[model samples]
Target: MLAKARQSLRAACDQLNIHPDVYEELKWPRETLAATLLIRMDDGSRRAFKAWRCRYNDRRGPTKGGIRFHPNVSLDEIETLAFWMTFKCAVANLPFGGGKGGVCVNTKELSQTELERLSRAYIEAFAPFVGPDRDILAPDMYTNGIVIAWMADEYSSITGQASPSALTGKPLAFGGTVGRVDATARGGYHALRHLEKSLEIDPDNSKVAIQGFGNVGYHCAKLLHADGYTIVGISDSSGGIYDEKGFDPLAVMQHKHETGSVQGAKGHGKTRNITNAELLELDCDVLVPAALERQITLENCDRIKARVILELANGPVAPTADRKLTEEGHIIIPDILANSGGVTVSHLEWVQNRSGYYWDASEVADHLKKTMERETQAIWALHNEMSLSMREAAYIHGLRRIAESVEARGTQAYFDGA
Candidate 1:
């Protein structure tokens, strides 16, 4: 993942003809901290979980990113994610750098008490390294609003102050942004809506297949399905359900919630269960790979039949496959631009937390929609202006922002006076 990240950065820098120093500056992380947290289990045993946090860059502002709790968490993955977040925030024109954190543990394997203890323990270990003005953490992957509340409470207790700005994705009762829960999917909805005409999408006839029925995936699918698109296929970690006549995303979500997976979502229609890989290869108008990274690589790139790819998952399309898909005229709304609604609202939550003021859900949704639409249009315009791939265009746009910031602060070469 880190290698692919560097490759994209290199391409963007080369395309922009940026200063060598700028590329050199971005080649490494600003800071990386790793630690092990030991907590006693209900079985009267102690288990140690490895955790990591990486600040990719702070040229723009304080770092902001998500803290995921997945079994595959690692320092390299966190660093790559942080680097992507830096670009993601810049692409959305947010005042934040990139930071990410994670602990290598499966949340499903833990009881409620065990999970709470682990989440708080993670905050305790990294409390000294994170803050609103330094690095703010949000939910990602297996992490959610409840988990974020725990972390925020831990940070507050540790500092002896109520600082909800130090964390995001909190429950609404604990100072979270009003519209943050569905921000990611809502943003993608606006982006795709902004591109529907250009992408030649027929809302009445468009067949959508979403891989991953998690938070981001479910919300995105739900929104798109409500917007008249045919949600023909959808999946979770276990598997997926597909129907030629299209399935209601909400019903599928309800089934998943009740049955622990979306594998057997019946009563609405006759749907066949499919694997994640099969879902990826399913012929559809728009394919949303919102599950994990490197999902649409070269091996499966040739099998993709979607006219458009909206990456609700970070780094879902490998760099090589991205080139191929673009060459084949498949419009890909990159993750930096597609899934940035979460961080954009995270910034808003930080602002509200700092001001000790809150806005209604409608206000948050309006702001998010405006930002996502504007940024999506901007990327489309850049794509046409430069005759570049969407991913390349996004990278160049963000790289320019970072390059300008880096030069402005480091050399003061472009400024007239100090």
Candidate 2:
């Protein structure tokens, strides 16, 4: 996955005629640390879990990304996510680079106490590698506010200083900024809203199908539905639910909360259960893959019917599949540009943390709206001007920023008397 992502970067570099030093610096992770976190289980036994952290690049500033806990978490995945984060921050013009961390474990299998021990142990292992001005960690898959609180508290304990800035996505009382809970979804929302007219999408008539029912996906559906879009399909890890006449996001969410899945949720019209794969092929105006990576790959890419794809998850659309979809006239709102709201708000949290001043909810929303619209518009302009796919254009936009920063310190041409 990292190699594939690098190919895209290489292509962008070639298109931009960027300094070779820029590609050299961005091709590989600057540093990656791996550790075995051993913890005591509830059954009086010890178990070991593999963990990794990759600071992909810090050319812009300190690295920032999330720590995910999942059975499928791998070093390659972390590095790739970090690489994406590097571009994501640059795309949003955040004063940070890219970094990511993960543990190979299923949170559902662990007791709360065991989870706490594992979280602290992770902090203990990577204490030397992370800081406010270094690599900041946020919550990702299978991790949430309580988990972030544990990690943040452990970092404080290890450093003997309250360093809330070391982590984002914390509880409000713990110095987390407002508007961050839905920032990722809201960022995509802002981008889509900005492009509605350009994409010829009418919220009153268009249908939306979301592949993930998590925080980001739910908020995305809720926001779009509120704006008069008909949500035709919704899915979670368990399964999916579809309706032709659309469903109310709040009603589906209430059902999901009560039943632990969206499979049986009721909609405005006929609601039926479907597989996650089927949700991707549903005829809709917008398809939002908010769940996992590589969901719309070569096999399923051909069957995708949505005219536009809003990627709220990192690497949800594979590179080859992205090309096919774009060639097929699908307007893909690339993940770097679409789902950068989380990191943008995280940057704001970092700023608020450093200044010891917190913005109100409205202020945070306003900032996010402005940043999302500005970046989205810039990327859209590049897409049209360069006749490139939105993904390619976004990469060029971010790559320009990163390459400029890299060349500012002087490239080989400067050293060679160009």
Assess each prediction's global lDDT (C-alpha) against the native: 0.90, 0.96
Quote each prediction's TM-score. Answer: 0.97, 0.99
Output the TM-score of candidate 1.
0.97
Tell me the tens digit of each residue's lDDT in model 2 across 216-251: 999999999999999999999999999999988888
Local accuracy of candidate 1 as per-residue lDDT tens digits, 266-293: 6346779999999999989999989899
Best by TM-score: 2
RMSD of each: 1.8, 0.8
> Which residue pairs show collisions in model 1?
none
- Name the runs in model 1 displaced over 4 angstroms: 267-269, 412-418
Model 2 ranges with Cα > 4 A deviation: none
